[model samples]
Structure formats: structure tokens, C-alpha cells
Target: MTLTLTALTSPPARVDLSPLVPETTRGRSAIEVAGTAIRCGRDRVGVGELFAVSGYGTDELVLRGELGRIDRIGAGMRGGRLRVEGSCGDHVGARMTGGEIVIDGDAGAFAGAELRGGLVRIEGSAGASAGAGYPGTRAGMSGGEIVIAGDAGQEAGAAMRRGLVAIGGRAGDGAGLRMLAGTVIALRGVGAEAGMGNKRGSIVSGRPLRPLPGYARAVRYRPPALALQLRRLRELGLEVPDAMLTGAWTRWAGDRLELSRGEILIFDEEEVAAG
Candidate 1:
């Protein structure tokens, strides 16, 4: 059974829709699902009052509307599938331990912040600090995968301890600031100051990159791990260019001010033709 929630109108204020997940509604009736309480700005309201809920739940959910201000759409989910048809507000998948969330439109800040497990796929762009830690916290997505088919805002994977963040389009400044451990793959160009103060992690870019002042060119070679990642990415339906799959990458070891174990791999398109 699939539960569908369509908003009659955009809520008057930002709404917290974290409770409307497949795990919570699995055994509930439509009426019970509607009765699920959610915070709307300073007031609390039931889903029934804001939208017409149809169908009982059984591990699948769909939310449709212009939800640019809504928050926490799938926070803390342990299992099941959730899909949003329109743009959404912040924290689209915050602290999720398991399950899958798919956003067909753009998502706001903290798109996958603090994700522990599971997969979050955003078909459109994401706002600042996507998959990053909250203020005053050193922890970001400890695990899981976030796939954004479009651009990403600043600090795309800041403070991530472990996980994979793949951005198909351009990334804003500070793309991997303070990264601890994880992998961030930028399919297109990345902005300046990427991987600043990164202690241990990998940032891979298919576009050309100027060597940052804190980094030193290591070598140009085909890393086995990178080849494996490219294959996996191709299987995931991401447009992994043919050049990247067989090309050499220029590795730069950097952030000398820190542990300097982090590395950045910039694809050398010239090598593809040379070969």
C-alpha cells in the first residue's frame, strides 16, 4: 500500500514533516496517518488539516507540493521509501539512519546533514552545507550516500566522517571544507578553496583544477580505487564520461596546515586523447 499526501495549498509557514515517513505509517490507517502531528512554525497541526491523505501505509510514501519552506521531510528514518515531487525546504534527510528519500526538485540547506545510513537522491540542486555538520558540531554525515544530479552550494561535504557525496553539476565555494573522511565526487567544475583544511578524505573532479596553494602535485596515474568508483558510478546511471573511465588523474596531496592525508584528483582530459 502506498500513502500519498498532497497539500491543498502551501502551508502558511515552514512545516516540519519528519513524522510522515513509511516506517511511522506502515501499519496505520489513512485517518491515523493524517492524525500524525507536525509542527507548523509556532503552531502544531495534523496532516489531515493541511492535506487530504489517501490510502493506508505499507513502506512507501509520496508527498507532492511546493514545499520550499518545509523541513525535515525524512529525518531519522530507519527503513522504507519516501518520494517528494516538488521542491523542499531544509534538512531533507537529516540524521537518517536507514531508508531512502528521493526529491524530484531542489532541496534546501543541510540536505543530508548528519546522515548515518541509507540513500538520499536529489534530482535537482541543493542549498548550502548539504551533507555537512551543524553549527558548533564537528560531525557531518557519518555514513550513507547523497546523490545530487544538479549543482550544490557551499560546504557540500564539510566535516563528513564517512560517506559518499556525488554532485553531478558545479559545486560552490568551500565544497569540502574540513572534510574528515569520505569521498566527494564533483562531475563538473568546483569553485575555489575546495578541500580547505581537509584532514583525510578524497575529492575527485572531472574538470580541470588549479593547484591550491596548500597542495602539492603528487603524481598522475590510474588509481585502482578510482577506477572502481567510476565503474560504480556508471552503474548508478550517472553520466560518467568515457574519458573519465579510462583517463589518468592528477593527484594532489594537501592542506599542509593540517594532517595533509587528504587528496584531490583532477582529471587530465589531455591524457585521454594522448592515449
Candidate 2:
């Protein structure tokens, strides 16, 4: 069964829509689903007041309408699938431990912050810190994947401990700040200080990156694992250029300011992309 909710109107203030995930309303009646309460500014509003709810099922949910002011669309998701039809506000999948959240449009800041498992795929551009650690936290996106089809704002994968963050377009500055482990791939390229203080991680760039002074140019070689990874990306619907599938990548290891175990891999041939 598939549950569908269409927005009837926009909220006056940003609202927390975290409670409407598939796990919570799987078999609930339309009225029961509509009766769900969500916080809007200081007051609370029923889901029915804001959405035209219908359907009954388990494992799938479809949300429609102009949902830009809604926040935490799938925060803390444990299981099932949630689909956002259009753009959404901040924290689209914050702190989720399991399940999948697919955003057909842009997502605001912290799109998948602190994700432990599962996948958050953004079909459009993502705001700052797509998979970064939450403030005052020790790690970000401990497991899982966050894929942005368009450009990503600053600190796209800040302090990531594990998982994969793939940016199909250009990624802003500080792509992997203080990362302890994991992999970040900015296919188009990345900005300054892409891997500032990572202890152990791999930051791959399709375009040439002027390495930070702390980094030393390492041998250029063709990575045997990248082909498999790129093929997986293709299975995920990302269009991987044929040339990107096969090439010699230059590895630069650094952030000597930290453990000096992190590496930034740059493709031998420059890759071109738009903003």
C-alpha cells in the first residue's frame, strides 16, 4: 500500500514534519494520519490542517506540493521509504539510522547530517553541509551515502566518520573537514581546503586541485577499486562519464596538521562541469 499526502496550503512558519514518515503512518486511516500533530512555530497543527491525506499501506509514502517551509521531513527514519516530491527545508534526513529518503528537488542545509545507515539522494542542488556532523557532535554520516546531483554548498561532508558522499557537480570549500574516515567524491571538483583536517579519509576530485601545503604529491596510479565504485554509482542513476570510469588518479596525502592519513585523489585529466 502507498500513502499519499498533498499540501493544501503553506504554513505561516516553518514546521517540523518529522512524524509523518512511513513507519509512523503505515496503516493509519486518512483521518488518523491527518490528526497527527506537527509543530509550526510555537503552535501545533494537525497534519489534516495542512495536507490532503489519503491512502493506507506500509513501507511507502509520497508527499506532494510546495514543501519548502517544511523541515525534518524524515528525521530519525528507521525503516521504509519516504519520497519528497519537491524542494524542502533544512535537515531533510537528519540523524536517520536506517531507510531511504529521496528528494526530487533541492534540499536545505544538513540534508543528511549524522546519518548512521541508509541513503539520502538529492536530485538537485543541496544547501550547506549536505552530510556534515551536527554542531557540538563528534562525527557526521557515520554510515550510508549522500548523493547530490548538483552543486553542494560549503562543508558538504564536514567531519564525516564513515560512508560515501558523492557530488555530481562542484562542491564548495571544506568538503571534508576533520573527517575521521570515509570517502567523499566531488566529480566536478571542490573548492579550497577540501580536506582540511581529516585524519583518515579519501577525498576524490575529477578536476585538478591545487594541493594544500601540508600535502605531498604521491605517485599517480590507476585505482582498481574506483571502477567498481563508479559502476555502483551508475546503478544509482548517476551518469558517469566513460572517461571517468578509467583513468590514472593522483593521490595527495595530508592535513599534516592532524594525523596526515587522509588522501585527496585528483584525476590525472581534468574533468569539466558547470555550477
Candidate 3:
């Protein structure tokens, strides 16, 4: 199955791609299809206006375009694979429960907002709230994995209840704000107010950061789980630096305002020197 995005004369009210029907969902064979068949902005415009679709397989869905305004490219996706050739708009994979989404370029805000299961991988930067709960909702990202290759905007994992978020680049302020449980790993430095009100989660970074006012220093140790995470990211085609995979980190516990179960792990420069 193939659909081509021709153009977007004007932004339609809403464009839902999941309802357009799919060719297949099961089987191990790679589904080599494209998103040119999906409609945009209330089906006001054809997908051909934005991209060209080719190839026909079973396990993969490839998209080629700028795709800066096409939202909900894979909403509620249950199975299979989605690969974007370029940057994408908001809600790239909103509420997806299963399958995989791979982006070769940057992603707009809410790239993986409210993701329930599966994996979303971005080779470039992402906007605010990569895996955050919706307004008034208590849970975010119950399961799944989000990998950002570049810097991220504010509140990267706000109010998250479960799952994992790994950033290969810098992260903006308010990261892990109000986190309930889960893991967030940043390869570069993170901004202020990180882990501000976290309860039962872990925020790990490769750089130093001033611990939040209420947080207390714990100890220095090398977490073994990070090794598994690095391997997973590598399998997704993300570049994980060697130093980060084999480094010691300073652990801190805090957010007394909540359960105080969450922790922030900052890499130790001295350990890196020794290695």
C-alpha cells in the first residue's frame, strides 16, 4: 500500500492517519510501504503534496518528506514499523501502544506525548514534553521507549509514571518534572529544576548539575542497568558514546515534597579521568 502527500494548501482542522486503514499488521516480513496514502488536515489535501511513497513490504513503513506540519503520523499504532526520512510535526506517535517509530530528522513538540507502549526514535532534536502526561492526567508513558538524538525542550518527561526516555544530547529545563516512576537518561547536561518533584524515578546524565535544593547526595556507583539501555539505543541506530556506557555516577535522592523515591545520577568527572 502506498499514499503520496502532494501538498498542504492550508492547515486543515484535524488530520487523523490511524483511521485511514492499513494494509497489514502482523508477520515478520519487513513491510516496505509509505505514508503517502495518509490524509492531512481533515483530508483536505493529499499526502502526495508533501512526499513520494514507494516500496511495498510487510514489516516497515517508510516516509520521505519535510513533514514539518503533518501531525499524528502514527497515532495509536499497535504493530509494525514507521520510519520518517525527515523532520515531523507535533504528536508524531501519540498514544501508540505497540510497534516502532524511527525518525531520521528532528521532531516537533510532543514527539511521543502520552506514549503507552513501543518505541519512538528521533535522530534529531525534539520539542517540549517528549513523553509527558496530558493536562489533568496523572499517568504518562506507562510503557515504551523514546530516544532523542539531539537536544530536547522543556519538561522532557513530565509526570511520567513508567517507561524510559534516553536523550543523546542536551535536555532543556524542567526535565523529569513531577516524575512518578521510570528512567530518563541524558548524555549531555540538563537544565535547572530537573527532578524537581520526582517521586519514584531515575534521572541520569553524563554531566554535572546542581542538585535540587531538597535533594541529598547519595553515593557514587556504576549502574548496571545503563549498560542494557545503551545496548538498546545502539540497536535503534542511536550513537551512544563509549565514555557514557562505562562511567561512574554520583547518585542523589530527593523531592521530599513527594515520596523521595526518585534519584538523580550525575556522572563523575574524576571517574572519567581515571578511566
For candidate 3, lDDT tens digit of each residue in 1-275? 53323223434444545532133422212222232245565454444444344444455666665567667777788777888788878888878888888888998887788889989999999999898887788878778999998998999888888998889898899989889998888888788899989999888877888878768887787778877877777876667777767867788887888888889988866733211
- Each candidate: what lDDT? 0.87, 0.87, 0.75
Q: Order of all candidates by TM-score, from best down to worst?
A: 1, 2, 3
Please tell me which model should have the higher lDDT, number 2 or number 3.
Answer: 2
lDDT of 2 at 266: 86
Error of 2 at 225 (Å): 2.2
TM-score, every prediction: 0.96, 0.95, 0.84
* 10 residues in a row with least lDDT, candidate 3: 25-34
Give the TM-score comparing model 2 with the true structure, all chains together: 0.95
Stretches of candidate 1 exceeding 4 Å from the true structure: 271-275
Clashing pairs in 2: none
Candidate 2 lDDT over 64-133, as tens digits, reads 8989999999998988999999999999988888899999999999999988888899999999998999
Clashing pairs in 1: none
Q: Which 10-residue span in candidate 2 carries the lowest summed lDDT?
A: 266-275
Q: Count clashing residue pairs in model 2.
A: 0
What are the per-residue Cα lDDT tens digits for candidate 1 across 156-210?
A: 9998889988888988888788989898888896788999988898988888877
Rate residue 268 of model 3 by lDDT: 69
